[model samples]
Target: MSDNGHQNVTMITCTAPVNIAVIKYWGKRDEELILPINSSLSVTLHQDQLKTTTTIACSKSFQEDRIWLNGKEEDIRHPRLQSCLREIRRLARKRRNSGSPTSDVTSVSHKVHICSVNNFPTAAGLASSAAGYACLVYTLSQLFGVDGELSVVARQGSGSACRSLYGGFVQWKMGERSNGTDSVAEQVAPESHWPELRVLILVVSAEQKSVGSTSGMHTSVKTSDLLTYRADAVVPSRMEEMIGAIRQRNFAAFGELTMKDSNQFHATCLDTYPPIFYLNNISHKIISLVHRYNQHYGEIRVAYTFDAGPNAVIYTLQEHLPEFLQVVCHFFPPEVNGGEFLKGHPVHSSPLSEELKRAINLEPTAKGIRYIISTKVGPGPCVVEDPDLHLLGADGLPKKNA
Candidate 1:
């Protein structure tokens, strides 16, 4: 609420980081509630590299709810969007009803106008929804003055969005409750837990995904029996072992589990009746490069993981970044000297080896990769205190220059 009067608009802006799952969530136990069939784990990347910035304004003068995503106006009546907005309001009402002093008194009945933008291009096939919905839920909670465990509400927007509520190593526990009350995300370790680790995103294509995650996962649940086995038998023990690996800072164990789980998830996608192919020639080539690179070194120095898209995310230590990056730059050179080559954290220069190049033995594929983002583990959602950074104007509309 604004200090001027009831007619005044109140606005808040926030940013949320993206999370890449090591243990993927491929199926759902319940679609409406967005409950997963199995638990999953992920590492939250730094907000400096990939993130969503959302601004929400509430005012009595607004006629109705409106939303703009990535500079384009969108329907506010979308079912998933409505689910997130309604759940936040309900929590605020419940807190007020309980005579809690922390509940927001104003803007409870005012219509809202939301504007969101992503730092990275949506065409990169990164986890945009994971960051978008998480930012939406976090910003809305700030406006509604509701706190404590908003992951359940965030999950309604996207299952993976729940994991974005925390930083570093996170686990989305598939709770046993039928009502989905206990299905929440918890932090397994903080970002500072592993300072030497780094992430590199190999953008294979900047095209929108042919199949979205929600629809794709639904198909897998219905047609793939392997999904049932992996969810029931494989993920349980794997989750425990992965946690131990993270705790002990064992790169070999952690890297192995990450690669295998990613492979199994894609295998389940193939087992679907029509079969979904998220990996392209570029993705397969990157996988081969990682394998041969590790084989030549006589150790697992790097690992690769893919989601429901062609992009490949590589996990390795900081000491290995320079050499591996040089290997990548050699095979997939940028179009222009400084164009579409790299984004995010910069890596130091290191020369590629002739023997290793011979071992890879693959022809250069020009522009196979759009760019590479070098980053590391980072914190979760954050509020931007600078007033000039706000995306909306006083009239509850997107600013011209935002």
Candidate 2:
């Protein structure tokens, strides 16, 4: 302990990539706890393409604990965010009292200032929340000189966020307990475990989702009975198969289970009374085209999965990217006119401009999608040690472009 309240002030930053569940986590048992009805598996995307960078700094100069997301100050009073902070603080205090090894000692009573940013669009239904919460917990753990495991803190943020704590293939164990204390994520395998796997994210629409995933899951759990069967029977088997596929490097088995699980998850959503619409017409079109292409190829070359929104995540081998890109380009050509690609004429368009028509060879397709991001499996959270990269200023406020 020193003049800075307790000891030296320190900062820690971390970045984590978003993951798309090949075997989705559809329904929840406890909304507040974010405890899923069944276990789920996901493939962590490369951080260079899609990820969240979070910086957590502890200093006696800070007046109160605060957080900033994408350059905008957020209410730290939000229970979800507060719970994560409290849990990390508790762990840090325990470590400090035990005389544990720490990278940098900070004032024990210092307040934490956190700033986070996402590389991709937040509202595009691309699991931005997962990456955000994951990075927040990971960065805070390092900043507070916290010792012990990191998964527990990550779980308090979001159930899926726990999986993002690990890279490559991860599994969120739906532990058998009334309290979700044991329900955390573990790395099934690393990216190097299966070096050939690749993920191609199709940015269908950048429009904000009408319904959030938390709300949608709540609606499905209350209204849909199909969710019960899927959770009890379908997901358990799928989880087992998915884990085995990853362990043995069985792409064929992996692809089959992935597609089936995604379809079932969406099916349960549709079965919800007054069904919540996630995928639009354009999403279906992409699915149909992918199925047709795979059929023509006469082998299982690609796999597509969607989260709670219309964005499609296609998985394939690194070697097959060129062929896959060539076919995908024909269907979703670049948006040369008005940021819209002409896949076919819109079934109901106000009016098609001549300039728009010429972009896709005057094709009727209504510029079916937004854009495509080609990426693969990425690493776990990392700290940005560069001072210039800090998102918070010396005054404990959000820096520009944070």
Q: TM-score for model 1?
A: 0.97
Q: Indicate the TM-score of model 2.
A: 0.89
TM-scores of the models, in the order given:
0.97, 0.89
- CA-lDDT, candidates in order: 0.91, 0.78
The model with the greatest TM-score is 1
Model 1, 1-402: lDDT tens per residue? 353543478899999999999999889999999999999999999999989999999988788999999888999999999999999998888888888887777677889999999988784558899999999999999988998779999999989999998889999999999889999999999999999999999988888999888889999999999999999999999999999999999999999999999999999989987899999999999998899899999899999999999999999999999999989988887775744587888788898879989998888788888889899999999999997899998777789876
lDDT of 2 at 88: 80
Q: Write the residue-wise lDDT of candidate 2 on 75-105 in tens digits.
A: 9999999888888878877877777777344
Q: Could you report the Cα RMSD, in angstroms, for every candidate shown? A: 1.9, 6.3
In candidate 1, where is summed lDDT lowest over 10 consecutive residues?
1-10
